[model samples]
Structures are given as C-alpha cells and as structure tokens.
Target: MNWIAALPMYNVTPELAAHWRALLAHVGARLEPWLAARGDSLALIEPDEQLERFWLRDDLLLSQTCGYPLVHALSERVRVIATPAFDIDGCAHGNYRSVLVTGAHVDATTLAQCQGLRAAFNDDDSNSGMNLFRAAVAPLALGKPFFSAVLRTGGHLQSLRALAIDRSADVAAIDCVTLAFVRDRLPELADGIREIGVTQSAPGLPFIASKAVPAEVPALLADALDDAVRADPALARRLKLTGFVRRPASDYASILDIERGAIEQGYPVLA
Candidate 1:
C-alpha cells in the first residue's frame, strides 16, 4: 500500500493540490486491503523536490519529459508503468514563440530581424526548452550561428524573466502549457509578454512505477489515471488534459536525433 505520487512543478496550485489528494484517496480506497497487509501509507511528492528519489524508490514516479536520461535513469530502478505521450496540457509554455523583451526594448518584428540573436534556455535536459527549441532553429542555421549566445537559466520561468529583466538574452522559447497556467492564475506576467513565433508540438508528461512493485501496479495506476481524468472535469478543463495516450520508448528518440543532427551540422549552441 506504499503508494506515492509526483506531479510537475509548474502545474502545482491549490486546486491541483486538492485534485491530487482526491485522486490519491480514490486510489487508496481501492487498494485498502493491500495497504492493510503491507502496513504502509500513501505519500505525495512535490515535483521540484524528491522526483529523482521517487524514481529510485519502489513507488510511482510522475512528471513530464520521461525521455532518454530519465527513462535510462530509472530503467534499472523502476519500470515505466503507463506513459501518455500527449497526456495533460499542463502549461502553455512548451512551443509558443516569444521574444520576451525588456519593457519595449524590442518587439516581435524587431526581434525577428535579428536572426542570429542570443537566446536563453531553461535546461539541457528539457525537451521543450532545449530540444524543441533547437529543432525549430535547425533549418534556419545554415552556415551562420543561429544563436550568438545561449544561457541555461535552470527553469522556464527564469528563462522568461531573464529575457525581460536581465537583457542578457535576445529571445527565449516559452512553452504554451506554462503560458496557459500563468494566464489563468498569474495574469500579470502573461499580460506583459507576447509570443513571436511557435515551435512544433511537444509530448506530454508520463506516469511511472517501480520495477519491483506488484505486477498489477501498472494496470492499477493506468486505471486510476483514466478515472481521475474522467472524474475531475473541472481539473481536466483547467489543465486541458484531453486524455491519456500510451507511448513507447522509441517515441522520444527523435529528440536525440535532433540533437545529433544539430551537432553534426555545427549548430552546437543548442547542445
């Protein structure tokens, strides 16, 4: 009965927190016998902390970008229970093209004029912040440097704020999912920023479990997720989680392929 849940850092809010509690309660109620036998309790791990630890534990690990490094990181420790390629549209921060300017320093049209301008990325491990952003610029960076400089800001919100306040970056890719979340909850920032371009669609988050968990764990996790998505209409609408779609390991290989092609073509700024 030692059940654990982890969700993305960006999507955590009071309502979402309540939603998760309810979902976990449903799961716990359904697995009460197992819980009694195991003499354990259910726990919820916040996305920003303990995600790596949860992946290592014989419990469920949930988050976005369940790609190469994460899957490989957990392969020996856990088994991927159910992965939805296009699960929840957690935030509008994925592929929305935007040159977050410093109080009218540059507009979208002006930013586009500066083709080889510097940009800031959230992280190297991020698919939407780094990988998808690289792919968006790959075709345009023929022989010239697409980005004069690239800074790793560690998080999407930091990347956005860096462009607006720091003046160190010319532009930054903002994910639509994060945008949506902020627009609905934190409108001040949303009102100040504007989108200049858009990248291709990126995949959604995945749900996982430990390899040593009961064989029925995967099925139970998937069923619970499906029920949660169906039962929580308000939450679903708030997050725009259309539904869960199953995916395999090969689905994320394209990200690496994009990385390889960019490196081979000498667009190593993205790498």
Candidate 2:
C-alpha cells in the first residue's frame, strides 16, 4: 500500500516549511533501507487535506498532531509514535508551553490586567493556543468571561498577526515552537509582539502513524528519526530538535487534565 507523511505542526513560514521538508527527506532516507527490509516501501508527499482529515487518512503512514486533539479527537484513530525533544526555551524532555503575547504597546502586564480585552486563539481544539491559555486564565476569570471577545484565527501566525498587525485582538497564546520559528525565520512578524507570559507546560505534539500500520512501524519510524538527527547535528540544531522520546498515549492525558482544571474552575471556555 502507498504511504504518506507530514510534519505540519510547526511550519510557520516558507523558510521553516522548507526546513521541515529537508528534515523529512533525511528521515525518509534513513527509513528507506529499514522499511524495504520489512517488505514495506515509504513515500513522502505534501498533504493537501485539512490537518485533522489528513491525520485520519488510512494511508497516513506518519504525521504529528497536537495533544489536545490527540486526547479529544484522535485518541483511537491514530497510533502514537514518539514526541520530538527540542533544545529550546519553554521546552524540555518533549514538553512545551504556550507563550502569551501582546502588542508591544499594550500596558497589561498580567492576565488580570488584560481582562475585558479581546483575545485571539488559533482554534478551540489547539492545546497551546486554547486549552493551555484557558487553563492559565481560568483562575483569574472567577467564572466569568475573561476576554471581552474571543477570535479564532485558525493558526498561531494568524493569532500573532491579530495581536501585532491587525490590532483586532489584544493578546494571544501562541505555541512556543511556532513563536521560535517566527522569531528565527520571520523576525519582522514577531517584532511588535512581546511575550507577556506562558502557560503550564505539557507534552509536545506526538508523531503518529495510521492505526492500520503494524505496531513495528512506529518503532521503526522513531529509530529512523533519531538516526537522521544524529547524522546531521546542524539540521537538528536548526530545527531545535534535540532527540526523540518514545511515549505512551497516557503521557498526553496531561493536556486533558489542564483543560479539566479550567472546567472545574468554572471557566470551561476561553471566553
């Protein structure tokens, strides 16, 4: 059967997208001999489907997805492969945080001070943009809406733009990895946006394989990714990828816990 793969989570810019493509090429190269040995052949293709739909495809040999969606929407549909460990601030041992950003001119120094302002989030299903942001603001909400309005920008870059350029929103929670990419590749977009705070850390996005793939596929993919990174220290550093960590599905439950904590605080939603 033909197989497909994508690493869609952190492609924040064209340059960054190119970098991910290069990394994928290296990983695929490392996996070729091993997969051929198993009577399996792999193919790399740019995915055209919406991310969630793409993840659920039967031929989705490999991909990476957010933890919130992993627990809520994709738990049983996909098999966990491994989480990439990044040697970047706000991340450790495959865990990452959301950086709460605001326009540099905004005077609000804390969440409480930002109450009644409009907020932007990538999507309701995003762990970094929504779940973690909600969890951070829940205690300060006192069971009421914290932001006067909430805007779903559909992506972390859009959320950052909402804060930095459009000025339609006062603040946003952006994935730290996305922020890192913007700051490194497209520094201008990050120029006017300043990180005011960060949310509690959770496991980073997990690489996954189609449920139909044999259990050994995930292990093999993980080994190939490690080998690829080890072979090119420069590529690994450029991507901020330190290593890969094989984790069980249970490890992502912490993302759900962060949401539940907010719900229990009576601020079930970001609004």
Top-scoring candidate (TM-score): 2
Which residue segments of model 1 deviate by more than 4 Å? 12-26, 47-50, 61-68, 71-77, 83-104, 110-114, 165-168
Tens digits of per-residue lDDT for model 2 on 121-223? Answer: 9998999999999999999999999889999999998888888888889988889988888888777679978878899999999999899987677877888
| Reference-based TM-score of each model | 0.78, 0.96
lDDT of each: 0.58, 0.87
Q: Write the per-residue lDDT of candidate 1 for residues 1-271, one digit (tens) a residue.
A: 4567655544535776665556555555656666677786667666555456656665553333344345345544555554432232432322123223322345545334547666778876666677667766766676467666888998777776666566677667666556666567665555545566666654444555666677776666667667776777676665566556655545555656766776676676563
Runs in model 2 lying further than 4 Å from the true structure:
37-40
Name the lDDT value of residue 134 in candidate 2: 95
Best by lDDT: 2
lDDT of 2: 0.87
| C-alpha root-mean-square deviation, each candidate | 4.1, 1.3
lDDT of 1 at 255: 57
Worst 10 residues of 2 by lDDT: 34-43
